[model samples]
Target chain A: MDKFTVHTGTGAPLRASNVDTDQIIPAEYLKRITRHGFEDGLFSAWRKDENFVLNKPEHQGVSVLVAGPDFGTGSSREHAVWALMDYGFKVVISSRFADIFRGNSGKQGLLTAVVDQSAVEQLWKIIEEAPETPVTVDLAEQIITAAGFTTKFEVDSYVRWRLMEGLDDIGLTLKHVDEIEAFEAKRPSFKPKTV
Target chain B: MGRTLAQKVWDDHVVRRAEGEPDLLYIDLHLTHEVTSPQAFDGLRAAGRSVRRTDLTIATEDHNVPTTDIDKPIADPISRAQIDALRVNTAEFGIENYELGNKEQGIVHIIAPQSGLTQPGMTIVCGDSHTSTHGAFGSIGMGIGTSEVEHVLATQTLPLNPFKTMAITVNGKLPAGVTSKDLILAIIAEIGTGGGQGYILEYRGEAIRALSMEGRMTMCNMSIEAGARAGMIAPDETTYEYVRGREHAPTGADWDAAVAYWKTLPSDADAVFDKEVIIDATKLSPFVTWGTNPGQGAPLSATVPSPDDFTDEVDKVATEKALAYMDLTAGMPIRDIKIDTVFIGSCTNGRIEDLRAAAEVLKGKKIADGMRMMVVPGSVRVRLEAMAEGLDKVFAEAGAEWREAGCSMCLGMNPDKLSPGERSASTSNRNFEGRQGPGGRTHLVSPAVAAATAIRGTLSSPADLVGSN
Candidate 1:
């Protein structure tokens, strides 16, 4: 994980409510052992359509994904978040996010911002009208700004800190190695120990 | 401020809680499968770490294991390697394993509950999302990633934050034809699949109380669909009755004490939730997904909404895209959507009761031409029970394929798959694009509906096929 604040860049509006993990990275691509190099697999099924927003040439370098409510629903596959990050998406703006996906994304340092439905609609309209429109999502301020519209979102303080520091769950846990070791030493006789 | 089931389980499992730190929660049971365990095992090996509590951990081969020819080597090289890797890892780590063809071998979620390994007020973790199914026993169960799997493997504990509780109380009596599947489907559609996010949902009220253990399992199995970490029903007489006499359940005096503890698992009458959703079961009908997401569903009698009918522009575009991908015409009755395949098994509804229900619908009617139907049991024990009851013969006589137990067409992880452009009516939880197979359009339905669809070669309720003989 890299330490860098996320901001919406070259936003290409593609709004689909209840966009499921299966659509993010189909189960076919899940066969691979390595988590790396899923960029090509992101939205592979939908990218076949020439008219799809993601297939457009101008949106190639876009980092912001403006989506509808209930984004990332179905299947608690962390691969969905990985594919998005691997595909260079820094921030996903939606009215709401699936619980597991939201937690998984936050852990992976992917900024998942939940704004009011009206703000989502506004962003959707602006990005749809002007393809490659850029929206600034300042994690430090917890605000998303685009085209004279601004929205504030809330995230867990610990998750926000982890995202800002680019620390994964493992990294966060490793930070307390000494404490973990101390706790391990206090374990009861019947309790098992890691080698 | 009464405790919800999740809080009760969480509090009981919390070994320690310090300032600015999460709880060091002890896990009572850890289940592993082939799909996600390989990487975790590799991580442990890379770190030269051994499993902390082999007695508490159990491994099973599913997801990638074939439902046919248990003796033969898997044809898919990648899947074969994954299964082999799990066996090697479990053997090296001294963890108990129930491999393919073993009576204990089955869908991990189904086997855990049936074996009485999933007890009330326990904390369970698995590398698979449907682990929430264990919550039906009043346990706090949720899925974890490979790294977390490794963490639990090495430490026998999981660091976690607290979750808010949501009570989805389904009141009133469910109509005669409406099953637990219908109730859950209706809830998913109503909540738009993200309604339970960040909340542990407790299923309460009359409708949930009336459900059998298998039905409760089905209800909790799809909690992930609503973005809930887990869904639970408090233990009662029904839960105790289901657990009694099970192979691993407590015996004699221990059983009495266990039941006593289980009886106190329910939320107090004054308990308040962060969110509450009241559903009237009578209003719900047999439901089916018409689009690529479970939330994009309607009652069996309703028509697929046209893009023009959507108030939001994004919704309109999504409706159009889903319609195009599904090759469905707007405003057409959902029942008129023709399906080439009908699948009635998955962790969601693939149990003994589900098999019996499908068998009742397909007792004598032959499958219509061009319709391929399969009845795959969730576990080997379920298969044996179905055979003993002669339900397998009924399915075979009705022109349906009776497959061995595994997560068979719910996901095309193994040999079961749909060819490109094939559409299916499935009882599985998801309806995403290509969920069944490449270019395979899936419509989530109930077992009875899947059986009826096989007979009619289109979406039809079981009531429609009734008396047709």
Candidate 2:
């Protein structure tokens, strides 16, 4: 995972609420074992239409997505975040994000910033008015500024810290390996064992 | 302050806590399926980490397994590789895997409870979202992502943050002919898809308590549809009776001790919640979704809602998009909608009781011509139990296809799927665009609804299909 802090890029406005993971990356493309290179499969179904937002020519090459409230609303697929990251999105700014999707994004160094609904509306309007407007998201300051429509976003301090430092979760958790083994040793025998 | 059932379970699971980090909450059980485990295992192997506790982990092949052609090799190479990868990975990791033809093989959610592995006061996590179904037993079941899957595999614990509690109290007696599926659909419609976000919703009040174990499972199963990561119900006599004497449940003195501990898991009378929502169950009726999302639903008698009905522009746009995707029109009666297929199985409603409910409606009725109705049990054990009672014969006589259990047609990972532009009245949760198949339309309903629709060739309730025999 890449370390993220103060990324500047053009924003793509996809103002769809409750845009589920199925819509993000359909179930058919989930068969592969390799974790990366899902860019083509991202919104594969929606991309068929000539007028879909991401398929529109001007929106191409944008690395930041400004979606509506309650984005990434269904499924526990980390592939959704992978698709976004693989497609060159460093941040997904929304009014609200599904819990699992947000957690998954945190692990992949993809920033999911929760701003107020009005702030999201502001960004969407600005991007719609000028497709090439530069958007800057600063994790340390908890603020997003695009076309002078600046808003402070809220993120968990721990997640913010990890994103800024480019931490690998599995590696971090491994530091507590002794504590994990200790917990396993105390587990009751009645619990069903896979072995 | 007294703790809610979720709080009590979460508080008890804390093995170690630190001032600056999330709680190191121990996991009692971890479940795996074909699609999600391979990557996590790869990550583990890449990092040279073995599973911290193989005893707490279990795996099954569901998503990619062919339900109809169990004897033949999987024709889809991608799916075949997924199943094979799961088998090899489990064998290498020292994990127990229930394979396709095994009697215990089925949907991970269903097999866990049916085999008594799902117990009260336990904290369960799975790679799939529907794992929330186990919350019916008073456990804290969470749907986790693959990175978290790797985390649990390594640590047997999650660095977790606490969630706010919401008491969704459904009071008053549910009218007859209304199933738990109807109750949950109505709740989602009332609260919208994002209502339960960031909170653990506990189903409480008179109506929730009166539901059977199967009913509670169906209710908790869709908690994800309402945007809640986990859902809970207090442990009671009904819960106790269901967990007793199952294959993995405790025996003799162990049984007594387990029950004693479970009895203490319900919320105290004065326990507080972060929010409260009340529903009068008597007002609910058989429900179905008319749009692409679970929140776009109405009673069986209600018509497709107009975009004009929504006050928010965002909601109106979503409704318009959904209406276009579903090929529905405003003011059209929900029951008048035609369906190409009726899918009567998934982790949501493929248990024995779900089968029995659909069987009662299917006993003497022939399915309408040109309608494709298929019943897939949640697990092979559920199929065996249903056959022992001759329900399979009744289904066959009624023209509904009976097949081996898996998540057949739920997400369309297997051979069972609707062709493009096909619409179905399905018992599974989620009606998202292309959820069943690419461009396949879905209407979420209960088993009874699925059976009646299959028999009538349209969206229907049992009341609409009377005298079909």
Candidate 3:
């Protein structure tokens, strides 16, 4: 995963709500071991339509995506976040996001910002009107701004810090190795164990 | 304040908590399957980390395993490699893996609780969303991302933000022919798919208490379809009896101790939930999906919904899209919708009880001409159990193919998928477009409904077959 800080890029407005993971990357693409190069498979089903945002040249290479409320609403696949990142989306702004998708985004340094519904509608309007409108998302400031209009967003403080610092979670957890070992030794024998 | 069952479990599992951060909770069990574990195992190797508690982790081959063959090699190369990868990973990690032919091997959710691995007051995590199924044991079972899976594999702990508790109390007895699947679908249709987001829904009330353990598991299994973090039922004598004699269950002295602790897992009498929703179960009929998502459903007798019925613009758009994709008309009666295939198994409905219910409906009756019916068991053990009870003969006589155990047609991971535009009555959790196969249409139903649909070549409940049965 790459470090994420402040990103300013054109926005592609997704006008749908409850945009599920199955739609983001269908189950057929879930096979294969390698995790990279999923850009082509991102929205693979919808991409066939000529009018999809990504297919339109004006919205090409946009790193920010704005969508309606309740985005990333189904399945626990982190592949959904991978598809978005692989498609060059650094930030996804929605009024609400499924918990798993938001968590997956945070782990990959992709920002899932929860803004007010009015802010989402406003962003959709601005980005739809001007296809090449640049949107700036600053993680440190917790703000998303597009074409002179700005809206504040909320994220967990720890997530913001992790993204800003580009910290590796496994490394951070490993620092407490001794404590984990102590707890494991004291764990109940009656509890189910793997072997 | 009295604590909800979920809150009580969370309080018991807390290993560490700090300001401005989520609580680090101890996980008693971690289940893994082929689709999601490859990357996590790779991460551990890349980071030079070891699985923290191999004894607390288990693996199985289910997602991509075929349901038609038992002793042969996997036909799909990708699925073969994934299963092989799990074999290697589990061997290296010292984790107990129930491979394709193992007696205990099956869908991770099905095997865990049945084998007494999932117990009351425990916190469990899996890379698959259907992990919610184990919550019926009065435990916290949540679906984590692959990255989180790696985190838990390495530490035996997950940092989880607390969730609010939603009490879904179902009152009254279910009308004859109504199943747990119908109740869950009705709840999802009443409250949109995202209704339970950020909440651990605790199912309570008279109706819930009256259900068999299998029925409770079926209800909790589909909690994820409603976007709930977890779904739990209070541990009672029903739970204790289910766990008492399983292979991994505690011995006499330990069993008494375990029961004592389990008795405390239920919510207190005065427990106050963050939110509460009461459902009148007696009013529910056999339910089925009419559109793409799980929420776009109605009673088996109701007509397909018009986009005009939606109050939200986004829902309206989704409804229109669903109608177009489903090839359904606004006024078409749901019961009259024709289906090409009837699927009788999945993580949601592939247990012995489900098989019996389905077989009861199909007994001494032939399937409608030109219709295909498949019965895939949840696991090898379930298959053997069903066969021992002569359910296989019942299905075979009715023209339904009784398949080997695995997740077959629940999703299109295996070869048991419908052709494009082919409609099916599936006893699976999801009905998303192409979920059963690319361009396949799915109508979510119970085993009874699937069996009845097979006999009639249309969506139906056992009541619809009163003349035959």
Candidate 4:
């Protein structure tokens, strides 16, 4: 995990609500056991279209993703977040995100910024008119700005800290090793009854 | 002041809490599968940790297992290794596993509930996301990661943060042809898949109360689709009736005591939820997904939304992109969207009841020309029951392929896969791009709709086929 500082990059907006993990990285691409190089699988079906946003020349190297309400719904596959990271998406801006997907993203050091629907619509309009319009997402300020409007967003304090430090869930859990050890020591030798 | 079911479960499970520290919560049931458990078990071995509570842990093989030829060796080398690893790991760790061909072997979610391992007031965890399916028994179930899987394996406890709760109440009676599947699809469409984030949803009201155990299971199975950690229906007489006389269910005096405890699991009338949503069941119809996400769905009678109709510029772009991938023209009637394949099985709708429902529709009818149809049961037990009822023959006579049981085309983890550019009407939960296979397009529908679509070779409701019978 690295220090939590906001990095800004812009792309041609590819906004869709409830963009599930299956769409992020389809099941076929998940054949391998290893969790590396899923960037190629990110939106693989959509990427086939020559005119898709990712294929647009101007959106190249963009790290910020502006999306609609209820983003990242369905399937708790962490590969979705991994794909986004491998494809250079650092922050996802949406009105809301699926709980498990957001948690999975947070665990992987990807930032999810929940903004108001109106602000999201504004950003979409700006991005639609200017495909390469720059959108600034500030982790420190918990705000997203594009065009002439700026909107404050919310992120859990603990998750914010983790993202700032680029810490994953395992990294966060390992931070309290002494506490965990003490708790483990108190466990009974006998296995608990199955519910 | 209203506490949702998720809040109740989370509060009950909290063992200890300290400032800036996660609570150490006991896990009641831990379900494992071949795909994710192998790595976690390896991690446990490297750390010299034995499974702390073998009784609480259970494993099954589904993702990589083939639907055909149960006795033959797995042809896929990687899949074989995964299954083999699960077997070896479970044996070495003294954990219980229901391997293929075993009567208990099934999709973990289905087997857990069917065997009474999933019960009210329990906290269930699995490496698979649809573990929420257990919540239909009023349990708090969640999907966990591999690292967390190892944590549970080593300690039988999960570090947790609390979640808020939401109550989604569906009132009034569902009209004929509207199934529990339709209701869930409608809910997902309204909430846009992320509606229940950070909340466990408690489904209530007359409509939910009327559902059978299998129906309730199907509703909860897709809780993950709406970003919910779990979806619960309170344990009642209906639940008790469903669990009675099961192979593992409590018997004699213990059954009475269990029923008493289960009765107490429901929320009080005054219970408060952090958020609330109300849906009118009468308005829902046989729903189907039109786009890549489950939320991007419409009633079977509706037409695909034109991108130009979207006022939000971002929505327009998304609509356009979805149309392009789906190869569907905007404003076209959804019923007119032709499909090449029809699949009826998965944890979502692969039970004996689901097979019977599809069989009822396909009994005397034949599949339309150019339609490729397959019926895969969720478990071996389901397959056997379907066969006993002659539902397999019904499907076969209707021009559908009847095969063995497993998670077949739902996620395409095995030999069952969709060819490139193939479009399918699937009873499975997901409709994401290539979820059926590479370049495969999926239209999510209920079993009834899937059967009808198989006959018509396009999207159609069961009502459309009822007249023909």
Task: Name the best candidate (by lDDT).
Answer: 2
**Candidates' TM-scores?**
0.92, 0.98, 0.98, 0.88
lDDT of the structure predicted as candidate 4: 0.81
- Clash statistics: count for each candidate: 0, 0, 2, 5
lDDT tens digits, residues B212-318, model 2? 98899999999999999999999899988898888788888778888888888899989999999999999988999998889888998988899999999999999
Look at candidate 2 and tell me the lDDT of residue A173: 72
lDDT of 4 by residue, B1-469 (tens): 5455565666666655777756767677899988767667877777676787798799999888988898999998878877888898889998888898898788888888777777777789997889888888888889876657877787667777777778889999999989988899999888756677787889999999999989998999988888888888898888888877776677777777677766767887778888889999988889999987787889999999998977967567777877888999988999999999999999899888888889988888999998999999888888888889999889989999998778999996799999878999999998877788887888999999999999987799878875664
> Model 3 reaches what TM-score against the true structure?
0.98
Clashing pairs in 2: none
lDDT of 3 by residue, B113-202 (tens): 888888888899998888888889899999889999999999888877899999999999999889898999999897778899899999
How accurate locally, in lDDT, is each candidate? 0.83, 0.90, 0.88, 0.81
lDDT of 1 by residue, B1-469 (tens): 7877778888877766787666777787899888767767877788787887787798888787777787888998988877888888899999888888898888999988898878888789887778999989899989876667877888778777888999999999999888998889899888867778888999999999999999999999988888897899998888888988877787877787777777788887777789999999888889999987777889999999899988967668878988998999988998889899999888999999999989988887899987899888999899999999999999989889988888988887888988889999999988888888879999988898888889988899888886775
Ranking by DockQ: 2, 3, 1, 4
Evaluate candidate 4 and give its CAPRI docking class based on DockQ.
acceptable
Chain B structural similarity (TM-score) per candidate: 0.98, 0.99, 0.99, 0.97
Candidate 1 Cα outliers beyond 4 Å, as residue runs: A6-9, A121-137, A144-151, A166-195, B18-22, B308-314
lDDT of 3 by residue, A22-67 (tens): 8888776677666677787798878988998889988988999988
Sliding window of 10 residues with minimal summed lDDT for model 2 chain B: B460-469
